[model samples]
Target: MQLDHVTLVTHDLEGTCRFFRDIVGLDDGPRPLFRVDGHWLYANGRPVIHLVDATGPARLSGGSSALVAPRIDHVAFRVAPGVEWRALVERLAAHRVPYQLTEVPASAEVQLFVALAPGVVVEFVTSLPVGAAA
Candidate 1:
């Protein structure tokens, strides 16, 4: 089966929205009113990322350094080919967001890894070539 969207908890709603919309280049859409505190973003009619405001003030999942752990990972989105990945890297740099480019096997596709915040990491991947692993 194909993968669906992923939700993340964030304290800054507006900032998170801006980061995903402006920096990441995801189109912003109207967020439906949910009982809880949060917002949603979609790409091609599929909800890709959902942001939820953490309930109350508690210590972060595993403190600020937790993200550095070996098991930590981020969500990645594949973009169409012929798209400029470096321009995205430049956009991240212009926004002062730290990132790296990693190449995966077989198709030789590249992924732009961008850490939006202390515990939030997202990647923009080059679309897989024809006949590549799905």
Candidate 2:
């Protein structure tokens, strides 16, 4: 089966939404009426990122609170090289978001990492032509 959306539980709902929208270029879109406060971030007409407000008393299946200490290492997205990749890099710099880059050995792909929050890291992978610079 194909991959679906990624959900993030955060105390800072508006800040998280801003990061996804202003930095990652995702659009704040429609979300169904759920009891919890949250937002749906869309990319290319699809809701790719779901943000849930964790400031309230919601608990997970294990009875633990959301984002008390995030267990996820990072979330990655495949991006186009050239213009798209460059634009993302520019946005990160413009917003002063620190990031690190790593080139995949034996592959034309490069991965860029940025920590959006204490435990929320975002990675962008861009594939370039062989022999092309990142």
Candidate 3:
């Protein structure tokens, strides 16, 4: 089955959106009328990342990203083979966002790691042919 979406529990909703928009190159997209604050980040006309504000009425209280450990270490997205991986890397560098790259074992995917927030890490992976890195 194809991956649908990755949801993040965040206290800084707007900052999270900016990170994905500016660094990840995702654009703001439509989201259903849920009784919460969040943003739908779209790529190729599909919502890939969903950010939900877990902040309480205080909005700055001990909640979500703040009051608990990050539930997920990272969320990964598959990039097409033709994507400009170099340019993407440069964009991240330009923003001073820390990231690392490594090859996936037994697969041709190259994984990129970036800490999106205090407790959030996001990954972008480029799919390669079998033995491509060999």
Candidate 4:
């Protein structure tokens, strides 16, 4: 059994899409019109991220980062090993998004990233041993 995707609750669908596209380098597909309110984004042909518009206002939190809770602290993506992770960081910096880099426990891999929103974090992990795709 593998992880399929994550549904994020947001008040701004277009803004979230822009965060993933411009900051995280994910492709932004066509805006999906729903009876409720939401949009879908695919990573490598799989719908890995879904943004559902919440029917309320934004609940401002006082946390420094959004990785404090367990309810989908963040969504992680895999990239090719040895890729220029710094370039991605620079791109995110140019966009003025705050992020932090860390290493996964028991592994020599580095995850790069930034905040998707005030309480939404995005993680880019590049340690899927060769020949692995999800």
> Between which residue pairs do clashes occur in model 3?
none
TM-score of predicted model 1? 0.70
- Could you tell me every candidate's TM-score relative to the true structure? 0.70, 0.86, 0.76, 0.69
Each prediction's number of clashing residue pairs: 0, 0, 0, 0
What is residue 121's positional error in candidate 1, in angstroms? 1.4
Model 4 Cα lDDT, one tens digit per residue, 9-103: 88787898787767666665665577777777777776777788877644437844544333567777776665556566667779887777777
Ranking by lDDT: 2, 3, 1, 4
Better of 2 and 4 by lDDT: 2
For candidate 3, write residues 5-55 as lDDT tens digits.
889988889989999898778999999999998999999999989999976
**Model 2 Cα lDDT, one tens digit per residue, 44-131:** 9999999999865545578665734436778999998899999999999999989989889999899999988877899999999887
Off by over 4 Å in 2: 56-70
Clashes of 4: 0
Q: What local distance difference test score does each model get?
A: 0.71, 0.89, 0.81, 0.70
RMSD of each: 6.2, 2.6, 4.9, 7.6
Residue 38 local lDDT, model 3: 97
- Model 4 TM-score is 0.69
